[model samples]
Target: MTTETTETTGTEAADIQAIKEIVATVQRTQRAKDPEGFLALFHPDALWTTGHGKVLIGLDAIAEFTRAVLPAANWEGEVTYEPVHIQFLRPDVAAVKVRQVYRSAEEESEGAPLYVMTKRGDGKWLLHACQNTQVQAG
Candidate 1:
């Protein structure tokens, strides 16, 4: 489901911190190749989009996808959140823009630009939806 970010002036520091934590958690899990851990940070009804209509709905699908993608080879990378931009939709929801660069065990580093929207659940922020694209250098 698509959501329009609410127009508001002052955003809360706690909410911004929460969003940052979730983004960091996702990157950590990817580096660890921990599917269950990665899936735990997402909402039960999350929509994970990996470009070109590749969408995984629900936590189970996301878990499967993570396991399939992350374990093929030993992988490690550093993801830097360059100028992360957070937009508050409500007190309990936010959208964040992040820039990530990843390097696998055998591949060169590549950058990707992403937008991830998260909802606060039971005092924690859980990713709800995401849109991303690879940053290609010409």
Candidate 2:
């Protein structure tokens, strides 16, 4: 393979790993109920639609909802968020599909969230828009 091809391949792998880390961080924040840390990953004009159909516009609204719910969430086992897929719409924009599993000793539930992320000029990836959908059990 050419040197340029190798470099591009390396970069793509790195980008995928970085995005995976971001998704994992999402789970960590949720499991720890760290609303502030979670909110830090969002863009200022980000929009989020919850699994239950609540539409939250902007970071402030998301912060409000997150701060209220995350800390008060009463779940037994830790939540898990996995990056199932990633698609780049542009060099600086991507759509990530994530699987969120909430596990407890006696109960388990799941959510499928689509995260649209944007890479800023500063090279930081921030969530631009997202939809959290409930995954029904069979």
Candidate 3:
């Protein structure tokens, strides 16, 4: 699956911020139980590996999984995603490190995910490959 690409912003800082916001949208979409909205952040051929080690290749696969699980997820409280780091692999590619935090009255936990994004020819950053990992307290 391929679609038109989007070019990134002029400055690195601006690009980083934009990409971070895109990542945060994942948290927002999940919290709102909007699977399609969450899936919209990814590239058509993007790969996503779940925290549970399930590998979803391509947006279609990701969408299927998201539709099946995201809405049924019963986690209480707000889920948050914060970008901790951003590394540019190329002018149009980035590796973003994110911190995913889930906070509720009963418990608080975190997930560490690395999202590889690409600046499309149209100037938007989209997730290319992502790995979701649960952050275990040591």
Cα lDDT, all candidates: 0.67, 0.84, 0.87
Instruction: List clashing residue pairs in candidate 1.
Output: none
TM-score of 3: 0.90
Reference-based lDDT, residue 64, model 2:
96
> For model 1, how does the per-residue alpha-carbon lDDT over 21-114 read when each residue is reduced to its tens digit?
7777777776677788878887888888774457888888878887898667355555544425777666776667777776556665554545
Please identify model 3 stretches exceeding 4 Å from their true place: 1-10
lDDT of 2: 0.84
Per-candidate TM-scores read 0.76, 0.90, 0.90
Clashing pairs in 2: none
Which ten-residue region of model 2 has the weakest summed lDDT?
Answer: 1-10
- Model 1, residue 78: displacement in angstroms? 3.8
lDDT of 3 by residue, 1-138 (tens): 111134545687678778868977887898899998998899999999999899999988999999999999988899988888778888789888888899999999999999999998988999999999999998
lDDT of 2 by residue, 1-138 (tens): 111112236656666777777887888888888999899999999999999999999999999999999899877887888887787777788888888888888988989899999888887788899999999978
Task: Pick out the ten consecutive residues of candidate 3 with the lowest summed lDDT.
Answer: 1-10
**Model 2, which residues run further than 4 Å from truth?**
1-8
- RMSD for all candidates, in order, please: 5.2, 4.9, 6.3
